[model samples]
Target chain A: MELRQFCSQSRVVIVAGKGGVGKTTVTAALALAATRAGLSALICEVEGKSGLAAAFGSDALEYDELHLDDRLTARTLAPDDAMVDYLESHGMKRFSHRLAKSGALDVVATAVPGMKDILVLGKIKSLEQLPAADLIVVDAPAAGHAITFLLAAQGLLDAIRVGPIRKQATEVVEMLTDATRCQVMLVTLPEETPVNELIETAFAVEDRAGVALGPVVVNGCMAPLRDQPDSITSLMAAGFSLTTSTQAIEAVAFRSSRHAMQEIQIARLAEQLPLPQIHLPQLLTAAIGRAELNKLADAMAHQIELLQ
Target chain B: MTAFANLATTREIIVCCGTGGVGKTTTAAVLAIEAARRGRRAVVVTIDPAKRLADALGLDALSDEPKLIDQQTWNIFDRDPARSGLAQGTLSALMLDTKSTFDKLVHEHAPDEPAADRILDNRFYRNISGALGGTQEYMAMEKLHELHTSGEFDLIVIDTPPSRHALDFLDAPERLMRLLDNRMFRLLMMPTKTYLKLAGAALQALLRTVSRVVGREVVDDAIAFFQAFEGMEQGFRDRAAKVQELIDDPATAFVLVTTPRRDAVDEATYFAQRLESNGLQVAGLIVNRIHPEFGSESPESLRALAHGNAAILNLADFREIAIRERETLETLTARIPSDAVGYVPLLDEDVHNIATLATVATHLF
Candidate 1:
């Protein structure tokens, strides 16, 4: 139950939530934080987006394990590429090359619903066992697909029953369900829809995959607007014509209420889920570059330290 | 600044495509609401099985069948579209039932009830229908094509799923066709009975050794699923072609939705190019949730009014955010073709109801 120890000890950490809630950014920050704490870490992405490249202020990240910083690395794990790698590592390099050449990798890997996920996770599983990094942080798909993803191994186990696929799925499921080795870290915004999806995803993560749900990182949360002398709404109700200046101030008032609502939602979310929560502030920076990322990384490190 | 009005009005189908968490679904729903308010009967088909769209539309749930918005539901949105003398049209919405849609497609091409049951009963089909890659998007297209041909409404708005596969939605039909048409796949699935009959004992043993990774039973089930399509491949291929043609129609519009973050903006640009490369019509882009800068109020005056108190401090924080967001958005908008971009400012509240969606529609339409 020790927060920092749990974070440090977990071998595979999954970050997921509703899309656009900054899950990728959070993943990068968590990896950066782990590296800061002097732990070898690898952040993984499978969505084929330029999120990490943009975060690192680069052009693109390759499927090859590319270094992000000292003790930190990232890779966009493509299923096709993963299958080829999986085969090659198993001494099927020629067969892998043929599969890639024939355009059959896509067809073969996508044969089942979770076929793609299995390959991606299988590769991650190998990486987890490797000494390349002590922790493997995955920027999984959004809430719905994430559940399907975590359960993919289980699904294959049920369907295939006896084969290499079943054996691979068994390893994946074992690693995923082991609380000491794996954890699901959900990232969400303090909003109705994302919070609702978070609740749904959290339960499914536990009930479906039997994995322990780790800390809930709340992103883009607003700080409280300080108390004022006179209320803007009351002033508006006292019958003054709304000028541009008045309107601007009133808008601020509305935003303050929204911030308060978010605070309440965060509380409600904590009550609803009853898990450890980490809060990330809404940034004032125009763009998140290396500097912003470093700041978030430090804050995350501090949060993990506080988990004790 | 773009011609969203026309795209919202004139197109037979409007696909709001975006990455997850970008308010794409809200935009689609608002577009449908706006079209109806503009006097065009419109229906929005969403892929969020979580019922978020239904909640946004003020309905408890949305099934595959289009449900017309009742008068009571319409009143929840503060504005009166009929009284505005603009739209006065009807609006209905539906949520995709992916499995049922796939089932329907199978049943249609099965050639008979027993044949349909054979494919439908296959373990692979039963387990994989909804979870199959690109199945949701394919079904969304299927529904779009169905609605377009049904003539039930003048407009169909597609809320594309947040597919991590991004461009796969556009080429789903082609991918499916390619897999089905693969000669290797045909050879692999060469029905167990035929395979055993044709292959010599030695050849059969080699085949079994090669296929054991996925299980012999899985191979059998896969062969059953594929062979069940013996006479139906052509029909499915033709249907896939027709779906492509429908998307290629000049009247179709693909609206790329995104946020103004550097990552989101870059992804949007990439998606816009992908749609064009696929030969689909790119109507425009909606950069949603842009923070609007407050106009012309000298910050000095506001600070002087507040006498260095908390109100100005809070307002100043938001003002700074507004200015920063505006800069970031301008940088992104410049990369996009000017005529292909529209803007929606950040709303203080999440777009969770018909009323809120109406507010969004104002900026959109």
Candidate 2:
């Protein structure tokens, strides 16, 4: 499953992983890829992570939707704002005033169990169902809770057997269950804990929700240094050989171990999951921006082609 | 002494707080082992659901009280079988079950049986206790207070839940209590119930609608739960306030834990800033999984020598790992407050069992 092929085919694509595993970066890269493909794409965020905004090189964007380019748009859904929008859409504005005045809104809103999730899902559903956009990519919350958020609509449907709530829940569930139109990708690092969590997340998504699992992107893999140990050791033993500097010896040794560790982790992950695997090299640069995202997009495009 | 070494002797409480999957539990265990080795009677408690401490300590199970480990138990606590031979000074551990702790709080505060039963039996309460983000943090404090007041342990270490919003634990009680104390809910319900008493048929229709939406059984259970907790919300509020005071006390110390990764550091920084803003005493920071800085050599020389030779390459890989590890260390040191950074190197094997923990402890201290 190449990134473009998957993006072109699916309406709802969720990027999820342990926090700090570059889910936002991957989401931005995919959105950029979609835009390059001439498809109008929207990158939606539920947790208000500014990573997306930072990736897009814009600080002025707020919770509302803003166009990143002619074909790409990005937006963040604040739970409170989403709640207000949801209430207003349901014609509860009159009740809102009364509720706010009497402190009923405080109680209802504070304990508004599942309201954040409901609104987030509602927003994603709205964006996906919109005729203007070809794809909607959600930079979802961290792994553990993202599952809960995705499953909330279905859970609510089960709890609420009748009325408008059930109808809304049904619509959300249908969108999530339509595998041809929806796909969930697990983003992970080549480390023990995150990899383990990613595997668990995959099982949970498949078992609970009937969503299709796409390629797993193992980010930040380090390739081992190619060199001979005896010569390096001999050089180190000889202490200042003209052929090698101490810093060079250190750098090679350091890179080699990281590369080996990463390889082991990647191998472990590949064996555990049946899904196609994409490996992203560890970049030396600290600040990743649109240019870096474009580079990643190119790589994803090639991977997508191979998958096809 | 290094900044972290000073922490070992000076700090009373070292709370290992971080985002999830950053090895907070293992780090906490290692710290406790180190403190104990330094002759402090250390006790580590974990509030995470993962229960990693047992695996780290090589223990089959951890009770509500501290369990001792290590072959040199003679150095601190007694290893003898006699009743009085058990040494008072040594390392120990306990795991906190947040839900059970919450249940205990309810039992302690509820005014009557009905109120207690309502809170305990309420579906909402059950869900909140089990799933709420901050409850574990609150419960952790409650347990810490219990251990602190017990006077048995010399040093107490706490491992918080791996929350992206690390400060949520500190803020949970207030958020939960505020929701419970929403004055508008009471006023709205008061008039609505009276109006329903007059318009019985209309009230019945509303009830039917609610029952259908939330499930008749769940609604009934909730009503029963609320009815039991009648007039007891204030008690819970007061207890929560007391707990908050204890958490804010100066004697308690918070230790932020993180890996070298950008995301982990961001979270640690956020936690540090929040804790500092709240006037909480943040003792120090622990950067785990640091790569060691090997002796300097250029990448070209090392690569040229490492390539085409398996042994050379493996050694080169070790050195490269060490170099990256150094970069991570430097990054962490620069980002974290200068006075409060401790470094722990990445080990080859999992730190599972007391012996491995002791090895880790040596490095941390």
What interface RMSD does each of the candidate structures achieve?
3.4, 5.8
CAPRI class of candidate 2: incorrect
lDDT of each: 0.76, 0.67
Per-residue lDDT of candidate 1, residues A8-98 (tens digit): 7778899988788888889988898877667878888877664677778766777888887898888888777887787787666657676
For candidate 1, give the docking quality class from DockQ: acceptable
Q: Given candidate 2, what's the lDDT at residue B306? A: 52
**Local accuracy of candidate 2 as per-residue lDDT tens digits, A1-308:** 54555677778889888765788888877777787777778888777744567666777456777888778888887666665666667666544444445443333322324545766787778777774478888888877677887788877766556655557677888888888778898899887656777888898888897778888988877656544444445655755354344444554556666677777888889899888887766654444667778887776666666773
How far residue A160's Cα lies from its native spot in candidate 2, in Å, is 2.2
Chain A vs. true chain A, TM-score per model, equals 0.89, 0.88
Pairs of colliding residues, candidate 1 = A19-B21, B37-B87, B38-B87, B39-B87
Model 2 residue B75 lDDT score: 36
Instruction: List the candidate 2 regions with Cα displacement exceeding 4 Å.
Output: A1-3, A96-113, A226-244, B1-12, B20-22, B50-55, B58-96, B131-133, B150-152, B188-227, B260-263, B289-338, B345-360
Fnat values, one per model, are 0.48, 0.16
